[model samples]
Target: MTTTQNQDTLERLREDYPGWRIWRSRRGTRPAGWVATSLTPQDGRAPTLHADTAEELELQLKNPPMGIGLDIPGQLEWSGGR
Candidate 1:
């Protein structure tokens, strides 16, 4: 029963994927949902994945989609080495 709203589940996702910031989106303007952004310093083309639930997000993290790249505005840093 690992609901997306569960803090423990979120924490585990964070631990499992360090370089990506896993969280249930409750940010300004953005609709509430699951989000993970690759923070590793790249050419601002880090991959940012989104899902409806934490479970799906974790799966995406485990196996990112092909051609999943985004030109981030600035130098993003993360550490979620496989």
Candidate 2:
């Protein structure tokens, strides 16, 4: 995909899964893979997921590391600082 497409996908993922920072790893002109880091780790369980593509990373996020998926549909927005 193009850089613009990649950026759009990244933004969508961030919106879909709140409290997370997603990005691609530096390899060359192209990225080697994707990486996701939880912004608000709960109970020290949030894990950094690495995947070969955006789809794979998203799939991994569906069943997050140690069952720490934070993407709950209809979940209220928390204003309190973590």
Candidate 3:
């Protein structure tokens, strides 16, 4: 996909998963792959999530990591934030 499309997908993912930052690797752009990041000041370091494509990343977001059991829908809105 195009850069704009990739950005749109990233924004959507961020909205769906609060406290999650997802992005493509530096190898290229076009949303070829993704990495999910979450930070906790006291938790030390957390493992990041990777996906080969936007579709796969979406799957991970809906289900979530570490058996958190978050039932997220396909589409989500950011609501409002900085």
Best by lDDT: 2
The candidate with the higher TM-score, 2 or 3, is: 2
Per-candidate clash tally: 5, 0, 0
TM values, all candidates: 0.60, 0.68, 0.60
Candidate 3: tens digits of C-alpha lDDT, residues 1-82:
8788878988988888776677788665333568887643223333466889878977776765563433346655566984
Q: Clashes in candidate 3: how many?
A: 0
Winner on lDDT between 2 and 3 is: 2
Clashing pairs in 1: 19-79, 19-80, 39-77, 39-78, 44-72
lDDT of 2 by residue, 1-82 (tens): 9889889998999889886788899887776798998776663445688899999999978877663555665785677976
Full candidate order by TM-score, most accurate first:
2, 1, 3
lDDT for 18 in candidate 3 is: 76
Q: What is residue 9's positional error in candidate 2, in angstroms?
A: 0.7
User: Deviation in angstroms for 28 in model 1?
Assistant: 8.8
- What is candidate 1's CA lDDT for residue 6? 70
The list of candidate 1 runs beyond 4 A from truth reads 1-5, 27-31, 41-46, 68-82
Say what the RMSD of model 1 is: 10.8
lDDT of each: 0.73, 0.81, 0.68
**Candidate 1 whole-model C-alpha lDDT, 0 to 1:** 0.73
